[model samples]
Target: MKIVIAGGHGKIALRLTRQLAGRGDSVLGIVRNPRHVADVERAGGEAVVLDLEHAGVDEVAATLAGADVAVFSAGSGNAATAARRDRMDRAAVVLVMDAAEQAGVRRFLHVSSINVGCADDPGIGEGYAVYLQAKRAAEQHIFDRDKLDWTVLRPGVLADGDGDGTVELTAGNPIAPKRARFDQVAREDVAAVLVELIDRPGTAGRIYVVVGGDTPIEKAIDV
Candidate 1:
């Protein structure tokens, strides 16, 4: 499969690139910095310099031509203000959706936050509320569109632990107790799930919440 990753320089995106490339898949990473080109290549993928926030639709479509799947994993850095976050997180996703449609790529994967569908939980609010709102809007845009095989992966708090490849998946809210480790999953495991979803037709149009578990990621998907 030919996969294109937006925000290719992101930690999770890089992990996904390496996983896909290692498996003999053609990977293309869209990045804004030229310095990341070598890193993408080092991970066994090609890199293209393009800013998702302002890139022209036609240009993005051209870049994505021949790609089988497009993954939107871009986010405004932690240092960015609220406005920038909306632009990059919300607006950028919309742009990617448009470009994917124009490029005729039907499989779209969005790396979204678990906060988007949280119930009336006090633990989520303020700055995180803004982020959640943006993610929800972006997700709705993709879900409401026709002719796209879209799946949203709402991973819990990400961790940098070893990729044991075990993951827990639930159809809906499954927040643990306040003191019970608040659902954390390894970044590599999340990437692995994304790769599996690319070919798993049953996963399309579903919103999956992923976390660490005793079962391997592929088995966890049976939930």
Candidate 2:
């Protein structure tokens, strides 16, 4: 399998790249900074420096050609300005979807956040509110599309260290509520889920919420 990851330098993206490449699958990471190219290569994946925020659809499509899957993990983090959130979190997702269609890539794996459900809540901070709104918009765009076999994975607050390979995965609307204690998930676990989803084409058109739990990842992902 040939996998292309946007935001190739991200922690989760790097982890995903390593797992895929380590198993002999071709992996390519698209990053904005030229300096991150070495990091991607070090993770056992090829690197393509392209800033999706400014790159045209055709430019991105060219990079995704012949790829089996396109994973969108790009984000502006927690401290991004509203503009950055709209550009990267929202518009960049749309750009990748368009590029995937143009390049004939049918599978799209989106790394979203569980916080997107808070988009309509007024209690959150303005910055976080904007971030959730952007995520919500991007998700809606994917749900409305028909060309790509898309799967959105919304993980809870991220934690450090590798997880124990256990997770609670729920699909469709009214997603499972976050656990009070094990709400945070390890980045490596999220990557593991992505790896499993990559081979499950039947999981397309599904929205999943995953967090640390008792069920093993392989069993929890049964849908």
Candidate 3:
């Protein structure tokens, strides 16, 4: 399948790109930084430098045209202000949705944070609150798209260690423990779940929360 991944330079996106490309599927990663092009290519996927925050729907649609699936995995970095969060996390998703519909690409995979509900948490700080709010808004937009076959994956706090290939995947929000460890999942594990979702179109239109657990990757994705 031909696939396009937004935020191609992201850790999870890079992992997903390599997995898809390794299987001989055509993959193109859309990145804002020109320097990241070589990284995507080294991962065995083509790259297109386009900043989704400023790019118009037509321009994004042109890149998405003829693509079988589009994945939105971009995020504003740690130093992001509230305005940047809204633009990159919320509006950018809307732009991609419009472009995907216009390009006639029905299958879309979106990455969201498991803490999206924190938008309503009074204890959360302003910057983090806005980020969660933006993610929630983006999720609603994807859920509302009738023309798209969408799967939203909300992962808990991401970690850097290699994946154990086991996860606890459940519908809606799973019970997150007080300790962050229960929620700490490896990036590669999240990427592995995405690969399964990409191959299983029958599992579309559902939202899943993934974290480290005892279930095997393949079995956890039996949605």
State the lDDT of candidate 2 residue by residue for 114-164, as single tens digits. 877777666766887798889888998898899999999999888879788
Work out the TM-score per prediction: 0.91, 0.95, 0.95
Off by over 4 Å in 3: 173-182
- Tens digits of per-residue lDDT, candidate 3, 1-223, equal 9999999999999999988999999999999999999999999999999999899999999999999999999999889988899999999999998999999999999999888866767777677778888998998888789999999898988998789999999886322222222278899999999999998998789889898899999999775
Q: lDDT tens string, model 1, 1-223?
A: 9999999998899999999999999999999999989998998899999988779889899988999999999888766777878888889898888999999999999998767765234676566666766777787787787878888888888898667888888774223223212588899999999988887878877878788888878777753
Q: lDDT score of model 2?
A: 0.89
- Kindly give the stretch of ten consecutive residues in candidate 2 with the minimal lDDT sum: 173-182
TM-score of 3: 0.95
State which candidate, 1 or 2, has the greater TM-score. 2
User: Lowest-scoring 10 consecutive residues by lDDT in candidate 1?
Assistant: 172-181
Clashing pairs in 2: none
Error of 2 at 13 (Å): 0.1
The Cα local distance difference test for each model comes to: 0.83, 0.89, 0.89
- After TM-score superposition, the amount by which residue 14's alpha carbon in candidate 1 deviates from its true location, in angstroms, is 0.6
